[model samples]
Target: MYLRTLYKYKKWLFWLVTIVIVIQGIIFLKQGAVATPFFNYGMYSEKIPYLDNYPVYKIYANGKLLQGNDFSIQGWDRIYVPLLKFEGKDTVNAEMIDIRNRLLYKLRLGSLDRKNAHFENPDFDDQDFYSWYRQYLSCVTGVSVNDLLIVKQDYQWNGSRLLPGDSLVIWPTIP
Candidate 1:
């Protein structure tokens, strides 16, 4: 009875399966060219490069160190995400330019003449960011941020645990 029902709808089933396989094949072929969700199965299979030093951002609000555990996941993201973006702005811009050039080349369009092709933010003031971040932090954490200190500390992973190394004050520079 089940086999008869399946045979009756065999044409429909065949067409559906063919469509799905074709879509998957297209996604597999264009995996590196574009970011097709879930189709790039090898994305995480690539070995990650081992780095001796890993930099961590430590934020001190009102003279007290803010711990990650103290805040909710989203709250912690709010705290550190901006810092990461600000610190890695140049690297991010370079990556974006590379992606843009690759996409343009793939589409048969020539790459940008200017290497730095308006990607860099000229008006991004450090002092302005610091001031705005201070206010934003206060609002996000619900604590008055009188003094904000952001430090980048490098740590080395020794098999099991992380060993702390040199620290650099990123914000409120000490002259």
Candidate 2:
């Protein structure tokens, strides 16, 4: 009787797992690569060449400009995600910058792309990604979400180092 019950439930378990995987795949497709970090099944990604130059932009939170330490998420968010996002992009003409800045810039650029329906029309505060970005800002800024205001500004490279680019807000009001 127990063996028969196990055999009967095995099919259900398999179906349940299959359904979960299908759901995950659907979400992954809709949300761009950021939504899911599943194992890559193809070898095409490995064939891509490395980029020496990448863009970097200034970020501010709550009117206070953020430093590199704030944006830095040791491994996953800072490095790996950018690598994944820029795998096939045109990088040859990009101005060469430090590796860390390159990755951070790519991650921010990926956030700007409106790939998911949820992230589209970003002015509405109730969206999942809006909330997520606010939460991320809170973490990076050490400020409560209620009081936080985020901005991205342009930074010009003046020969040896980056200088404020026009002192203009590039991303004025999160959208």
Candidate 3:
């Protein structure tokens, strides 16, 4: 009787085992490719194999980023992000920018009027850059998502961050 029951369910068991094997195979394939960089290293192009899904399309025209979204050029690539004009208040954070741009965008957040990016403490520095930056950033408190923000690197207040109103000019020198 037990043998008959086992045989009766043999087909179901076979398919179940096959499904599990297929899943394992896919996981293994992804793991094998885990060594690859998501931003796509080694010259920006589809010529590289198995790296097509890299999120950033890293626009290149005349061998430079002309305009781009959800992409990053390799190395110290430079971009002259047009001055992001502000229409209202906004809050800038790492997660929000990362999701918007599809990259881990880091920000130093300071005023274009300031010269540094450090939010200094008398104990930390003679001045606080973030505080100066907040004077501008805090405008986000009651503003719409369509506000503007002049972003810069964590130290260089020359403009590196991007907000909604800012039209990012993709054409810039590649680092």
Candidate 4:
């Protein structure tokens, strides 16, 4: 009788365990997303030395300015910047592809372009890349990928200012 009862409850127990596991996974994955880290080493090239010199910016969250080098972000609000609504359109071609590759190679070391001269990231999915590029250029500060829709165009891309420019580089430091 006891074994029969236990067997009858097996399905419920399995579902309960599955739900708990999924919840745990979500929590762990979210923590990792919020704490994504990057190194600010002395890369060979520097268009803007703003990051190289400053190396660190205080983390801002929910209108709060935080200390330390650890930048935690989540959802759209996690990204704080002057949102620039990109609505213009552009064309995608070999020349345009090369432009972005060059920009990436220049700003970031170990860029995809550096691996092979003709190497283009096959994963560049913005089919209408020209529009994407236009939007990026329009941004003066930072942009959140989740907010890249016309219905919700907020124009304050703080991350844009975090890039390397022709004459300056700024770096972040951990406190």
- Model 3 Cα lDDT, one tens digit per residue, 1-175: 5445654789677666666656666655564322222222334544744421222223232243334342365211322221221111122333443443432223434232142233211332212332342333234222222322322222212244332332333223124
TM-score of 2: 0.32
Positional deviation of residue 69's Cα in model 1 after best superposition, in angstroms: 0.3
Query: Which candidate has the highest TM-score of all?
Result: 1
| lDDT by residue (tens digit), candidate 1, 130-153 | 898999999998988999999999
lDDT, candidate 4, 1-175, per-residue tens? 5445654789776666666656666656554222223223335644753333332222222234433233444322232231222112122245766666776778875356655545444544343443454344235224333222222212322565544323211111113
Q: Give candidate 4's whole-model lDDT.
A: 0.39
Residue-level lDDT of model 2, residues 5-79, one tens digit each, is 645889776676666677777765664333344533544745765333334444445566546554556622652
Sorted by TM-score, highest first, which candidate order results?
1, 2, 3, 4
lDDT of each: 0.81, 0.47, 0.33, 0.39
- Could you give the candidate ranking by lDDT, starting with the highest? 1, 2, 4, 3
Mark the 10 consecutive residues where model 4 has the least summed lDDT: 82-91
- Residue ranges of candidate 2 with Cα displaced over 4 Å: 1-57, 70-128, 139-143, 167-175
Q: Report the C-alpha displacement of residue 83, candidate 1, in angstroms.
A: 0.7
Tell me each candidate's TM-score: 0.69, 0.32, 0.16, 0.16
Evaluate residue 41 in candidate 1 and report its C-alpha lDDT on the 0 to 100 scale: 71
